[model samples]
Target: MYARLFPIIAVLAALLAPAAAASDLTVFAAASMREAMERIASGFEEETGTKVVFSFAGTGVLARQIEAGAPADLFVSADADWMDYVTENGSIDAASVRQVASNALVLVGASGAAALELEASKIADFLDDQRMAMADPDTVPAGRYGRTALENLGLWQSVAGRLAPMENVRIALASVARGDTPLGLVYRTDAEIEPNVAVLATFPDTSHPEIRYLAALTEGSGNPAAEPFLDYLTGPDAREILQSLGFVTDKVE
Candidate 1:
């Protein structure tokens, strides 16, 4: 069911706090990029001696924070629409926008759970009366993609009220990994990092809009490291990290 998630108010407050010191670069990135982005930032810190700080959240939340002057040096979003939102609102420099990576959507369950067909009638059978966890389908990119996949396959009606939607893709992944939810829908990259979750099925690329990760330097950011870090994210090293984490780094589409 669609549960209200007002608890995020506290989270938003923290993310919207004052900007970082000039010596450190502040980045607001999508939740699904946590592990990979951390690894990449660590490498950047080692190589350039510039510290990188991050605020990871859903694309919708990050975009809103940026719009309200979150003071982030950079913004990376899983959904292009959210990036467009920030860009249109003057939160980020539109000219610096670039597609960094692409990802696939997947259905996952507890590690030992059996896999099932990605069919319309079979979805309910697969759920087995338990709610399938998902990101907030209305605003979150992964959730929106999952819902669109189900709708495209005529399975939306079957799972209508049978959801345990969370705030972001990572939370949904965590829920299934911890056995709090038997099933969840998340990015392939997100599923790979959690050993306790098994990929039950992958959503067809045609089932939803293209899944692309876009990065950009925040509009009028005076921090010198901002542009460099954004470039590093799309560099070979970052691409390698993204591919190792199961993200499609070959092309943005």
Candidate 2:
């Protein structure tokens, strides 16, 4: 009894500008940041008149693309491992790397599902006989964190073989929202945007590595807005938008 896999979320351009101009910026970001990044990009375009072009996918996928010489002005990764992946491959400017935000891990269930504690026995009973939805624990950052959290709580065996693993966090969120699964493990911010899913249990910070989103300029990027746009992401306006969407941006860097 192993986990089942679902279709991968297609990697696609998010904010497509009419055409690439000198002032246009191209960004590669994680799928989990799609909504927040789109909002931040739109605001960046409106305020600076610099059109932003985006590609959203899993952090590992985007990191490999950048390593293979993808043309991107900036890269925002969901975790440091992938950021370190690109940095080690010289795909991004290590000097410009900075922490943008951090997030908490959570368990979610169909809307109106009663919130439950993270205790192994309680979760097992709440789930009954259904599988849980989560990102691919082997590759996706959210899944990796989720797995680690479950293991930390002594609940890994409770749902190990009963998982419906998707390619990314949003897909897992969709699974619970659509009632395709009884529960899901995703970032708190991810659970916030989907109205059909409610937080059931929260994983403590000690359960896994600190979840962080790091942003940096890609190597050899000469786009004029590349640096400024990266700076704007951690600025007051962008931070405000991110916070509104339930993201935590308390970093002083």
Clashing pairs in 1: none
TM-scores for all candidates: the values are 0.93, 0.90
lDDT of 2 by residue, 100-119 (tens): 88899999998899998988
Q: Cα deviation of 99 in candidate 1 (Å)?
A: 0.4
Alpha carbon deviation, residue 190, candidate 2 (Å): 0.9
**222-252 in candidate 1: lDDT tens per residue?**
8898888988998999988888988887774
Q: Which 10 residues in a row give candidate 2 its minimum summed lDDT?
A: 5-14
Once fitted onto the true fold, the runs of candidate 1 whose alpha carbons sit more than 4 angstroms away are: 1-19
Residue pairs in steric clash, candidate 2? none
> How many Å off is the CA of 64 in candidate 1?
0.7
- Evaluated with TM-score, which candidate comes out highest? 1
TM-score, candidate 1, is 0.93
Task: Assess the local accuracy of residue 48 in candidate 2 as a C-alpha lDDT between 0 and 100.
Answer: 89
Q: How many backbone clashes does candidate 1 have?
A: 0
